[model samples]
Every structure is written in C-alpha cells, then in structure tokens.
Target: MNENQKLALVTGANKGIGRAAADQLAALGMTVLIGARDARRGEEAAAAVRAEGGDAYAIVLDVTDPATIEEAARWIEGSYGRLDVLINNAGITGSGRVSPAEAIDQIPSTVDLDMVRAVFETNVFGVIAVTNAMLPLLRRSPAPRIVNVSSGGGSLAIASDPDGPFTGLPTSAAYSPSKTALNALTVQYANELRKEGFLINAAAPGYVATDINNHSGFLTPAQGATVLVRLATLDADGPTAGFFSADGPVPW
Candidate 1:
C-alpha cells in the first residue's frame, strides 16, 4: 500500500451490499479489504475487483468469531498501518425469514431464543467485536469513519405504530432487534469518538434484493450500497450519531 492511499474494510464483502460497498470504496481510490468468512469466495470477489481495476483484496474475517475479528484487525494494522474506514456490513436476518408473500411465523411471542442469540451474534455482538478490535488502527488514521449497516425495520417507532410506514412488517426479535441494537451502538461510539475526528453513523440500505431477504426487495445491491458508501466516506462536516437511508435520515 502507498503511503498516500486510504484503507477501508467492509465485512461480508464476498457478496451482496458488502461487496458493492467494497467496490464503490475502491473506485474512490481507497485500498479496500474485503472481509469474508469463506476464503474461497472472498478471494474470488477480490479477483473480480482486481479485474475491474480496483485496489481490493480479500481477508478471512468471520464477524461472529472474535478470534477472526482480532486476527483481521492485526493483519490490517500490520499491512496498512491504519484504517480510514470500517463498514460493519456483515449481518444475518435469521433462519426464520421467508418471502414477503408468506406470513412471518417467527413473531416475538413464538420466536426461538437460540435463533435470536444467533442473530445477535452476527448482527450485534459481531459488530462490537470488530469495532473494538479495529479502533486502534482507526485512531491512527488522520480521518476515520465507521458506518454500521442497519435496517429500516429496526425502527421501533415505525414498528410500534399501526399506521407507520413499516406497519404490518414481520415481528423479529432476532433480526430487527439486533439491528436496533446496532443503531444504538453506532450512537454510543459516535458520541465517544466524534471529538477525536471520528465519524460514526448507522445507515439503512432500504429493501435491497439480497440473500437476506430471499430476493423480495426491489432495489439492487449497488443501489442499496450508495448510502452506506456515502456514510463510510463522510467529510469532516458530515453528520455523525445519526441514522440515514438513501432517501434521508431515518427516524429512530
């Protein structure tokens, strides 16, 4: 890596919006690290980005595994010295999710506890592990940013009201609540680091058609990634401790 080049890492970058964010960040002249759980898929994605002339590489990073997160952080610090951006995009919607055409049976009343724990393991705790592991490297950068990829369904206000935009949405203690926790985590970190030239925020990618949703979404991965990429590369004057969607700020 060149001394003048910026470094960014996007978790779950082997596919979906994570891959799109990695590609977009690389296009903007950052040396993007694709953090994927599977080595083969990660390498393939990195190869694809290289074929497209982007400075991108894959690293095995399973967010749910603290060891992997720590190892990845150490690797980044050793390889590039600092991390300009960290996009926590690795997440799972839980095994209970199905197509929109079907009824969501995994409501809070009957949701499995193990499923919820599994969801939080990736969507919430995993983010905390990776962020904490990467903070040292992030602080080394002149300008650092953290973007937590959240979901619109995580909005408690929208989910609680019958007349709200997200009314009739599936009740998910596992997925939705995990994202809500992520949003809160974003604010807490922003408040702690904002004065130190770090900008931390949460971004909702709208309903992007990825494997998480079983392709029920209308937007493409690239389109969904725009807001996340935007947040990840925020200027000094950009807003922090906020939740945003492609359209605008999301109500918490």
Candidate 2:
C-alpha cells in the first residue's frame, strides 16, 4: 500500500447505499473495504467494485457483534496500520416490524419492546461499537473523518412541525429514535475530536430505493449516496458536527 493512500471502511456495505458509497469512494482512489455481516455477500460486492476497476475488498464485519468488531479493528491495525475514514453505514429500519409493509404504524404508543431492542442493536448500538473500535486507528491518520449515515426521519425539527415533510412519519420509537441517538453520537464525537483536527458529521440520505424501504423510494441508491460521500470526503476546513443532505443542512 502507498504510504499516502487513504483507507476507508464502510460497514454494511454489501448492498444499497452502503455499496454505492463504497464504490464512489473507491473511484476517488481510496482503498475501500466493504464491511458486511455476511462474508460471501461482502466479497461479492467487493468483486463488483473490482470489476469496475476500483481498489476494493471484502471484510466480514457484523457491527452488532462485538467479537467481529474487535477482529476488524485488529485486522486494520495489522494490515494498514491506520484508518483514514470510518463510515458507520450499517443500520436497520425495523420496517415491516409490526404489520407487513408498515412504517407509520410502528408508533411509540404501544410499540413492541423486543422490536425496539432489535432496531437499536443494529442502528444505535452498532454504530457506537464500530466507531469506538476504529477510533485508535483513526487517530493515527493525518486526516481522519467519520460519517454516520442518518435519515430525515431522525430529525426532531421535522417530526414536530405540522407542515414539515416528516410530519406524517410514525412515532418510530425504535428506528427513528435509534438514528436520533446516532445523530447525538455524531455531535458528541465531533465536539470531542474537533480540536484534534478530525471531522465527524452525519449525513441524511434522502429516501432512496433500497431494501430498507422495500425499494418504495423514488430516488436511486446512487443519488442518496451523494451527501454521504461528500461528508466522508470533506476538506480540512469542512464543517463538523453538522447534519446535512444533498439539498443542504438538515434541521437537527
């Protein structure tokens, strides 16, 4: 590996927006690692990128699995000695949770507790696990960055506004709150690392056609991945602790 080349890892990158971001980053000349819970799927995604002439590879990484997180960290240390970018893109919608193909009905009024746990396991807690594990490697980079893929549904400002785009969204005590927690995490990390020259921020990929939404979205995965890639590749003077979309800053 070239000493000047940057290394980026994207968890849950086997498909959808995660895969799109990984491929975009690789095209920009960074060595991108496709992190996934399933090894075979991860390898397939990486191979797809390689076939497209990008430097990419698969590494099994189930973000909710502590052992796998630790092992992934160790692998990075032994192989690259440092990490330039860490994108916590792995997340679950908890969609189709209660009723089949339901979103608005996953309300907080009487949502299932077990369902909430499962959502947080992957969305909120999983991000924490992966970010914490990769921090040491990130510290060693001359230019370190962390991008958390969030959603507009996680925006309280929008949710509370009667005229807001997300006003019709469900209470989503599970999936939505988990992402809200992630946005909070992004702020905390960005503030903590601000003085250390690190840029940590969150990106809200607009509703995109993906498995998470059962491909019901109108936007393509590539379109949704734009802001994520932007945040991941922010310049040294770019804003941190900010929530943004392709259109602009998202109301926190």
Candidate 3:
C-alpha cells in the first residue's frame, strides 16, 4: 500500500447497497475495506470484488460492538496508516411491520420500546462510536471524506407534507427518527471538521430493492450506491454538512 493510494471503509458491506458502494469505491482505485457482521459473508463479498478485479478486503465489523470497532480501527492503523474515506452505511429498520397499513400505527404507538432502542443503538450510537474511533486515522489523510447514508424517510419536508410520498406512509418512529438524528449528526460533524479540511455529508439513496424491504423497492442497489460513491469521493471544495439525493439537495 503506497502513501498515495487511498483507503476507504464501508460498513455493512456484505451485500446490497453497502456492497455496491464498496465495489464502486474499489473500481475508483481505492483500497476498500468491507465491513460486515458475519466474517464469512464479508470474506465472500471481498472475494467477489477481487474476482471483479477490484481492491477490497473484509473486516469483521458489528457496528454495535465497540470492541469490534476498536479492533477494526487498530487493523487499519497498522496496515494502512490512514483512512481517506468512511461510508457509514450500516443500519436497521427496527421492528413493527406486519403490513404497510398495520405498520402505520404500529411504528409510532404500539412498537416495542426495546425495538426502538435497538434501532438507535445501531443507527445513531453506532455511527458516533465508529466515527470517533476512526477520526484520528482520518485526520492523517490530506483529504478526508465522510459520507453518512441517510434516508428520504427522514426528511422533515417529505414526512410532514400532506401530499408527499411519505406523507401518509407509516410513522416509523424508531427507524425514521434514527435516520433523522443521523442527518443532524452529519451536519454537526461536518461543521466541526470543516476547518480541518474534511468534507462530510449525508445522502439519501432513494428507495432501492434490497433485503431490508423484502425486494419491493423500485430502484436497484447500484442506483442507490451511485450517490453514496459520488459523495464519498467528493473533491476538497465539494459541499459539506449538507443533505443530498441522486439528483441534488434533499429537503431537510
């Protein structure tokens, strides 16, 4: 690994959007670290990338596990010495979906309290944990970028609108709120890191077909990963502390 070669980390990259993001990053000539909770899945994904002629490797990374996060950081520090980009793509939808209609009331009122806690534990707190743990390594790079994978469901404008796509959608008090909090955190971190020349942004990869939704989405994983890869490889002068979609800025 030369000093000039960039290194990136993508969380929950065993498959779907996260895997797509890792593959794209590797295609862009970066050494991508595929973070997955299951070691075998991570290695398999990494092997697939290598078979496709991309530079990628696997790491055991359960976002909720602080020990695993620390271990990953130590491995990166020892092997690469610096981390140029980090895509926090790992997240969970939480429980409460029997059906779309039933999900509506279930999410806000009848949802299990433990489910909400678990959602926040992985989506919100886990991000903070990984970022803080890797900040030192990121600072070592000349140009560092952080792309937080958020969701359109978290957009206040859409969620609050009367005629919007998410207007009448189920009130995902747990998942939606966690993503919203992630967007807020992205802004705060970007603001603080701006003076240090780090570009940090939150992006919503429009509804994509993946296991998370039981393959009901209209878009593909590649479509969702496009915006993420773009943001992850942003130029030094690119926008920071902002929310964006495939087309452009998403309403906060």
Q: Each prediction's TM-score against the native?
A: 0.96, 0.96, 0.96
Span of ten consecutive residues with least summed lDDT in model 1: 96-105
Q: Who is ahead in TM-score, 2 or 3? A: 3
lDDT of 1: 0.88
**Candidate 2 — what's its lDDT?**
0.88
Candidate 1 per-residue lDDT over residues 49-84, each given as its tens digit: 989999999999999887888889888878888899
| CA displacement after TM-score superposition, residue 244 of candidate 1 (Å) | 0.3
lDDT of 2 by residue, 1-252 (tens): 589888999999999999999989999999999999999999999999999989998999998899999999999999999999999999886665422236665678887888889889998889989999999999999889999998887888987899987555456778878878889999999999999889999999887888766687888989988998998899999999999999999998
Tens-place lDDT per residue, model 3, 1-252, is: 567889999999999899999989989899999999999999999999999999899999999999999999999999988999999999988753312434553467777888889989999999999999999999999999999999987788988899987655577778888889999999999999999999999999988888867777788999999999999988877999999999999998
Candidate structures ordered by TM-score, highest first:
3, 1, 2
lDDT of 3 at 103: 55
Give Cα-based local distance difference scores for all models: 0.88, 0.88, 0.90
